[model samples]
Target: MTKIKIKESKASTSIPTANPENLKKQHRKKKRKILWKNKVKHVGKKKEDTKAMRVLPPKAPQEFSSNWKTLQELLKQKATSFDKSLPVTQTYSKNHTSKKENVKGIPAISGGGKMGKFKSVNKMDCDPAQTSVPLATLKSERTATDKNSTEGKGNSKEHKKRKNSDIEKEQADIKHKRRKSEEHMEQHLEADIWFDDVDPDDIEAAIGPEAAKVARRKMGIEDKPQLSVEQVLVKEKAFAGLTKAVAMDCEMVGVGPQGEDSILARVSIVNQFGKCIYDKHVKPTEKVTDYRTAVSGIRPKDLKKGEEFKSVQKEVADILKGRILVGHAVHNDLKILFLDHPKKKIRDTQRYKPFRKEVKSGRPSLKLLCEKLLNVKVQTSEHCSIQDAQAAMRLYTLVKKQWEANINAKSKRKCVA
Candidate 1:
């Protein structure tokens, strides 16, 4: 094969330049962008600094002008502070006017005849000794005058109306920005106190007699004729009607290997009239694992001196037999005693429908029941069996009619079935 020689095509080696008009246009566009950015930044800065440019109300120049000599003397007294504390005066008209009003006797090098501007002061015209009032005294007087003016303004109903109207306008504006629910809540935020004219009977009707008593106590109001604590706790004589109804409470100590099992430690029975019928500490058959002294209020000494469990059980059974048994969680009490009672005759405050409803929970404690229904506090620190029994009996008495009627209605229905 023969090698063939070929000539190369000729082309320009120089780089191509852009159109001059296009370059000019690009340059103009670049310049405009920079100028626009600069303009935007300047506008934003001015908006932020608007507070600095705010105009204040013009002050009377006569106050400072008349007391120029006294003011000069005052300035001289604190020359160091006056020189050091001299603020950088703004070029704004408001700032100039304020400065002129403060030191009115000073001559202005420029802008003397303009509106809100002060003329030159001649120091020679006024005698320094004419008004001998000290600057300190004048300042105090000015403060007193200002206070008096504010008080006088506050006393005026028209001023009050204007202030209230202004407040209402602001509130209306805010309400427009908020939701209807928020406005409703804002209306409720305002609270009024009228303790002086509050009748405790009215309060009792509204809240409860117990809460009313508390309110009355706080207000230093005289209490109504009520039973004393001793009287409430121990009645002089038991009511004959309460013999059939009795409330019993048991205090138990922990037993078994883990101390979870409960055994009867003490027993208390109270009649419907808040009178204790029977109270005794019972010695447990099993060895006590936990005394539960914090809650049960039973000590080792009490248990040592307690009666036999069998004897106490028999006594309790005899008292509770064929009677309306009132207790908080009476099932637990009966279980601990190893005895059974008729369910129809049992009035357990814990299981009561009305009580559970008020408590807003299925299991209501003895303390809670007493507080809610009887408006009495019991078992505050240590469990008092007698107090609890009394509380439970009182609770039963509160709804005795409704409770008995319901029981009768249930029995009748059962008989029909």
Candidate 2:
């Protein structure tokens, strides 16, 4: 009965059906699964490689040989040889020998001999009668010896005196020659004038009436009297009304320790004609801390009767009113006076372009500009307010035409714009 059922049960085989859309979908799904497995395996391999590289240690740096070591070894060998050649201990010979030779009549003493033996022999050979001689004879011999010594000493003294006198005379002659040479040099200095190219007549004409008089006196052409400080201030007040431009300068003294705080000590103003219009010493409001005599040239005696600050300020303001102010670093002077002027009317020689060729932005010193442009040496020792003001005015005069033209051109352009 079981055989009959087994014969009827045969293995059944199923076959897939072909559809273009369904086959394409199956192939895509299979490709995706294979790619995902390959990606996972590749990532695991990369992680294992990184772990192996991290576990290893880094290599150490190698050392290099030095060239100086060979040189040092050679030097040490030479030093050792020099040390071996030197004697270890000093020794003396048994015989006593002198490095100098003995005289022909002199006898050499034995090593064990004493010089006292010769001295005793000399004492025994002296005659007793010589010691018993009269005191008159001894005195006469002493006087004769003294006279001979005195004559010899006098001759030597006279010779030394003659030598000293000769040396002194030579020194005096050299000094006289040096003085003459210095005098000659001074004469040459006077002859070689600073402004040789400029005509003295033109300079005389350009100067103010007062300045021309002073120049003439200096040049031995006139005998005009010099003006006093008060007289000059009075004249400046009268001239300020007619003058269109003025140059001013101020000297300051220290009012605090270390000379850090500046206070007005002196003020000087000059017109375009280069004549001093105002020159006065101003007393500081604060207590005087430093006289600064070495730099300001203002001594205690000069400041004894100084004018009040307010009065000086009033006078300066009146003179500078409605006028072109020309100066080197004029801002410092105005600031000290506690006054303010229009910037358009101010001309600073320190900021002038032609004067700043060597230094592009830095302000050149007044002394340097005077020496270079005007061929005049200024501020050689102490500073003088009148001299500085005159220098500023002269510098302005040198380029006055060009400077005024530039200012007018700028004003015209501004108005047009």
- Of candidate 1, the 10-residue stretch with the lowest lDDT total is 107-116
Q: Tens digits of per-residue lDDT for model 2 on 297-357?
A: 9877777778999999998999899999999999999999999999999999998886788
Model 1 C-alpha lDDT per residue in residues 102-200, reported as the tens digit of each score: 434332323332233344443333333232334565577567657978888878978889999999999998878787776565444322223556787
Clash counts for the predictions, in order? 0, 0
Off by over 4 Å in 2: 1-106, 109-242, 358-361
Give all TM-scores, in the order shown. Answer: 0.48, 0.46
Candidate 2 accuracy as TM-score: 0.46
Determine the C-alpha RMSD for candidate 2 after optimal superposition of all C-alphas.
Answer: 34.9
Pairs clashing in candidate 1? none
**CA error at residue 4 for candidate 2, angstroms:** 99
